[model samples]
Target chain A: MDFGAMVDYLPLFEQAMWLTLRIGWIGILGSLVIGLVVAMITHYKIPVLYQISLFYIELYRNTPLLIQLFFMYFALPRVLGVGIDAEACGMLGLALLGGAYMAESFRSGLEAVEPIQTESALSLGMTKAQVMRYVVLPQAVSLSVQSFVANIIFLLKETSVFSAISLMDLMFVAKDLIGLYYNTTECLVLLVIFYLIIILPVSILGTVVERKLRYGAFGS
Target chain B: MELLGLDVLFKGSNAMRLLQGLGVAVEISIISVVISLVLGMLFGIFMTWKNPVARVISRIYLEIVRIMPQLVLLFIVFFGATRALGLNVSAELSSIIVFSFWGVGEMGDLVRGSLESIPVHQYESAAALGMTKGQIYYHVVIPQAVRRLIPMSINLVTRMIKTTSLILMIGVVEVMKVGQQIIEANRMVSPNAVFGIYGTILLLYFLVCWPISMLARHLEKKWSN
Candidate 1:
């Protein structure tokens, strides 16, 4: 398994892991913003914007993330005449791709909130924005906690695709280390462990949140 | 002529190469889907079994698949496993193996969820009718589970097809890989080859996946009614 080779490569792996986490966090936060906005657009059923959001959701969701990354990394720069660094391009691709799925998840969550809740909030003299801000968004978040967490796990795993663009992420580092030492198995094990360290807690938290939302005192 | 840099998609051999790549994608997807479905069904049944060992094994399998990215899993098998095991597995074969194992986890969960969703009364009624366990599963449980399973399984098939794009990263000459090659080959002559080629691939994928999703939704509506 070339344990010594893996030990020597530990620092490199750590750096790459940090990069992966950075890209993942950036993508996660970006998607949350995009998902919330697009989901609300659909929820409000605004004429033109609703249609655009629907098309965006279907277009992104239907295609592969790799293709999306390729388009953004390769085509967008050519068309826009602007150079983008690998890190920025990778993060942008993940954000746009993850946003689509998040939009779907958020849309379902928003729909699960009852129309009556909004109506009562309105009748109580709250503006539409305030109603959505308070009554709908909080309950919707609680209701879709499971899907929200699932989307996070998905976003985390997807950061690996950034390696294709040479983003210096964990996967790219592992591949480079393997190329150097030919210790493919050891490097692979280390790769899995690095990801598991990150992913396991999130998944366990997902289950915990799901249970809490379902049976906890808040009482959905 | 260059309408948003999409005109190159219809130019010359680009279309043919992409079609060829699409064929490879479909071939890999079909092979993986068939293999995964068979194993996935068994895994699903095993997951729901009462035996402690069976349950633990299935749980571990499910968690590993859930936690790991598909691309990393591909790297592990193609690069890691082949070296460690001293075997010369082709990229296509490794993809099949990874996707099958992945399919087992996803499909098994779907099966488990659908099986659990069946009301307890169905089983009790079968028992009261003097049906043996095998008869109960064959006649009662399987039928009801199949109803709930078909739509989700179809969705899984579409997912497998879409995810097959990942195989390209491992050196498999699938649709996206072909598109890349075309873009590189035409980089000098056609400035918009990247847009044209990838846009076409995107449309091709949309064509394939959108219908399957629609079909799944249709079946869900039909069966629920």
Candidate 2:
């Protein structure tokens, strides 16, 4: 249990951390775009799609995310007649699952925007798209910051499950290293610290954004 | 093998798989929730103890639990802790330990909230009634607090069941993992079965979780009334 033993795996763990961040960035960005579109379409109260997306969100939100990851890895390729690599499967699974949650968060933010804001903007000679782009989204994004951040932390954690599918995510590296070395405790301890380093800054940023929203700087 | 349309739901084999998955998911949820509730109550009670030693330990425990992810905690227990301690832990046993320990922290926080949310006079009046401390807790504080606790605890149950899927990462044959194996086995001939099976798995989760969610809502309304 010497503390110095952890330092031996430092370079490999750093490479793993970089991979996790890369996956997180791609997954989070893709989901945000997809979620925002889905959320807005649902928010506008589209005829059939509104009900459909509602059902989708309900199904995704209630299930365990690890289940979703495995489902994607094993299922999607067969259905679509495509050969998806492990990374693609993992990322896509994460986005779909996380997108559903993000849609809910964005919708909460969208709902918080009073109808009056749009009405006033329309009265001020703004087009619907223009009003949404310039006025609604900025505020909604800011307002949803806390839920969004929490969901991201959640997404990061669930990424570990992608290891079950042989994705080269951070936890996979740790698990694989432990298998080779039989240093499960040390490897996992390093993994936890690596996550905390990434996560703590996000938490602090979320709090700051929340405070800004509460004051005059953010939401109206 | 990919199931398209609503016809797959009517298939006997598919339907049975759904039912089986639902059962395991529900069993895991119920066990973890009960374990956590008991542990959480104990931790909550520990929070109120006079000993600074107990209070500090509880505080440290809860903070660590809160900061740590459930998946990481699962890994720590199943992979790291058991190995380090030379313990041969079963997957289900490890899942229970990981979830319940996390639940204690969560439930403790909820308990603290319910306890603090009660007005001070309730406690003072109970004390003034010539009742003992145990009587005050059992008769006065707990019954009222139980109302608020029910809905919150129900939410925790939903979370626990959902989190239980992480057990599959350690090779426990849970619903999702079962679906994965089924899809993989069938993928060569039954191309469509992938989405079909996974979709069924998702719906099974929905069935298990939705009822509890409705119950939580029902409790909240009943208690508020």
Candidate 3:
């Protein structure tokens, strides 16, 4: 299985892993912001913005992340007449796609918060924006933390697709290693294990967070 | 003007290729969904049953499917499986196998959730009524579980449909692949054609998936209430 070559490639894979992590984290944060915004806009049912947010969520969620990445990498540049680095394109694709799911998660979280809390905050003379920002978003985010984490992991898995656009992510490195070494089995095994290493700890952490939140770790 | 390459759709064989691709995509999604549901149900049953080996096996399968990307799995099934098993398999067949493997994990988890959600009293009452294990499952548990399962399963189906786009990466001539082909063929001739072809592909996917998603949401709402 050319185990020696696999070992020799670890340095390269480590670099690629860093790139993947960089892009994945950027996508996660970007999507969180986008998701929260869209969720809020729609939750309040703003006249035209609500419909636009709904369209954005449905369109992104329904389509494959692969094509979305392609659109960002290939079509967007030509349409806008500008060059975008593969890394930025990959991050943007993941962020946009992740945003849709995040929006749904955030929306559900917003729905989960008791209406009386909002009413009481308003009665206390707080603005709607202030109530949402201070009282509602905290509880809503805590409630949806588990699903939000799962979505993050899903976005991480999706960063693998960026390899198709020639991004120097872990999956792309693994494919390159396979081509260079002609040792498919070892490369594939290493790729799977690499992903497992990244994903398992995050999933365990998600479980712990969910448990803590349920137990009022962040304040009920 | 070119209407931003809208003319490409009315051009030669472009639209036909897309329709054909859509047919293939739908075909793969349907066949894989059916197989996945059947096997996933069995796995779900094993997951809930009181057997150590079965439970462990089911758990491992579920985790692997959940954690791995479908692209990786498709590669493994298409490239790894064929070589390891000493078999010749077409890309479409390989895609179905991979998708079904993923489907089993997802659908099985849904089934497990549905089964677990059934109240304890339901089982106890069935047992008290002199029902055997099989009879209790058939008459008492499954009927109730079906309500939860239907909506969740439909959601999975929509997911499978969207995910099938990944099959093109492994050389399957599905909708996404067809879109790429048309775009490649027209890239130089019409600058706007690239956007136009892909726009069509996106619209096609939205048309197919949006309805299913709406239906699944409707089911979820109806069943939950």
Candidate 4:
């Protein structure tokens, strides 16, 4: 295709990449926090909060992130009578959607810790919170590491949709360039390459980490 | 009251348009799922074959599909192909192509995993009984593999359906696009209509996906035992 056009558009794509990474990292962190809290609530089976967390997870997990983004960006502002910008809406929507998936991952991790481990810790006169911290959380974190990496990648790919809400993410920049110059091939090639640049390292690193964890767990 | 914005849905043909939009989304999902299932099964078998070339090619294909965002793939197929290769692919066709490309990778992996999960002794025993390779797969392996395959593929179907929402970007008038059209048309008359319209669209997707996922979970539980 057109190498010249691609080179000319590099700066715009760079700017968009930074915006995407900034929002993606923040959304990833936000989802991790929300996921951890929700997983804890469900794991401990807290009275009302447990049910609420389950509902939240199910609702978010089942619905499309695009619709969630639309509802937050377009609908929420009208209903709440407050203005929310596209970037903020993108970050918020990603966090909420990613949170549900992360919660499920973490919950499965937490459940994977054997009952005997908790029982032995409890019999040792350790407090419930202490047992959770010392006995359960560490193991659970290790177990959930692979899924966490997966969820992170999933969330980052989802940042592509942020364009719909008018965020100038990589996809937005590519579409904008194509609209202006009709360089669809150049723009799309750049889009795919940039996405691979963002995603491939994480995926490779994830596989390495998962293998290491497997060896560490099984002594194989 | 106008505050809730539910009135907009009842007015004129808004509700009908939404249903039609839902139909388009479902239509794409079903077509893509069918194509992926058949092709992915073959790909899955190829993956399990004892050939280095097939192994390396399948690995690269799977990784590429996994690493690239589906939206970028969609843009490439829908926008780039039209200009670069001078192929006139419609939005719906492009969506099906991208989704099936994605689905095949996912389903192929699922098939390979389930196929590999069946123990070696089962194959040996069937061989000892003098069954042909094709018969072995049809009678012994496939029956067991189907158990694991069903629940996971159901999950994939739900994932594919949810992902069809992305087609709206390429200008496919799917459910999300219809919701946007309704809100834009009523923006002045009912500024709050955005809330109801999008919320309804969200509910519609939830309704479509939730039961299928539930069935998947149920099947996994039942079959696992």
By TM-score, the best candidate is: 4
What is the C-alpha interface RMSD of model 3? Answer: 1.4
lDDT of 2 by residue, A72-134 (tens): 666566556677787777677778888898998999889888787889999999999999998
lDDT string, candidate 1, B1-225, tens digits? 473556666678767888889999888888988987888888888888999999888888899999999888999989977787889899999998998889889999999998999899999999999999999999999988998999999988988988898888788998888787877876777777777777778889989989898899799988974
Clash pairs, model 2 backbone:
B1-B190, B1-B192, B1-B193, B2-B192, B2-B193
lDDT of each: 0.85, 0.78, 0.85, 0.91
> Best candidate, lDDT-wise?
4
What are the DockQ scores of the candidates, in order? 0.70, 0.47, 0.65, 0.86
Query: Chain A in model 2: its TM-score?
Result: 0.89
lDDT of 1 by residue, A175-196 (tens): 8878887878888989998999
Q: Write the per-residue lDDT of candidate 3 for residues B1-225, one digit (tens) a residue.
A: 274677878888889989999899899999999999999998888789888988888888888988898888887777777667878888999889989989999999999999999999999999999999999999999988998999889889988998888887778888778888887787777777777777778888889989998998998888785
TM-score of 3: 0.94
Backbone clashes, each candidate: 0, 5, 0, 0
Deviation of model 3 at B145, angstroms? 1.5
lDDT of 4 by residue, A1-220 (tens): 8898899999999999999998998999999999999999998899999889989998998888999998888888888889897888888889999999999999998887888888999999999999999888888888888889989988998889999898899999999899999988889889988898888888999989887776324411
Of 1 and 4, the candidate ahead on lDDT is 4
TM-score of chain A of each: 0.93, 0.89, 0.93, 0.95
- Candidate 4 C-alpha lDDT tens digits along B69-153: 8999999999988997899999999999999999999999999999999999999999999999999989999999999999999
* lDDT score for candidate 4 against the true structure: 0.91
**Candidate 3 residue spans exceeding 4 A from truth:** A124-126, A215-220, B1-3, B125-139
Residue pairs whose backbone atoms clash in candidate 3: none
* DockQ winner between candidates 1 and 3: 1
